[model samples]
Target: MPLFEYRCMKCNHDFEELVAATGRTKVVCPNCGATSVEKLHSVFAARADASPIPVPAGGGCGRCGDPAGPCGM
Candidate 1:
């Protein structure tokens, strides 16, 4: 099962759901019971086990440094 993020267009409520991939498209807003909920594409940082990888401080792009931009990349 994959966790999916959903946003309600009617109530503007955000929530997460754990559902089978086949059922993902059938999910509706739980708060407002509306079918106008949209599945959101989420960005997740890679993790090792339960530990989060440390990011270098000082606003530098640890991956590719060429003067940091607004996105820190």
Candidate 2:
């Protein structure tokens, strides 16, 4: 399941719901019980503990000297 954000037009309420991806877009407002709700784009967070592999400045594989950089890595 993915979390979706919604805003109620009638009551101007904002909330988030855990819903199925194929579920209906028609959501009821919890504050006023209004069906006039607009689905919102949700933001997500990600974390990376590992550093990115550095690309050679010469534009090629530093170790094997492949011009395309090891099949573009």
Candidate 3:
């Protein structure tokens, strides 16, 4: 359970929080509760001109899960 992206430096208010582990965790700024929170460097991006989810070459496709088949890279 790790999802934490917070930026509310007293009211800049951007949020996402579901963290169960990370040292000294006391992040609080649900729009102006303001523990002066700032931890924002989250990244997940995929669309460098992307189109490939055709995904059926057998073997369940949980990222190269090869049960003796279809794990051809």
Candidates sorted on TM-score, descending: 2, 1, 3
lDDT tens per residue, model 2, 13-55: 9988777678566679989999988878553321122434345
Report lDDT (CA) for all predictions.
0.65, 0.71, 0.65
Residue range 1-73, candidate 1, lDDT tens digits: 6676789999999988776756435778889899888777542322333454335676554456534523332
- The C-alpha stretches of model 1 lying farther than 4 A from their native spots are 23-25, 43-73
Q: List ranges where model 3 is wrong by over 4 Å.
A: 1-3, 7-12, 15-24, 29-33, 36-73
Q: How close is every model to the real structure, measured as TM-score?
A: 0.51, 0.53, 0.25
Best by TM-score: 2
Better model by lDDT, 2 or 3?
A: 2
Backbone atom clashes (below 3 Å) for every candidate: 0, 0, 0
Q: Per-residue lDDT tens digits of candidate 3, residues 1-73?
A: 6676779987798897776665766879877787888778442222322544334556454446655654435
Between prediction 1 and prediction 2, which has the larger TM-score?
A: 2
The candidate, 1 or 3, that scores higher on TM-score is 1
lDDT, residue 33, candidate 1: 90
Residue 1, candidate 2: Cα error in Å is: 0.7
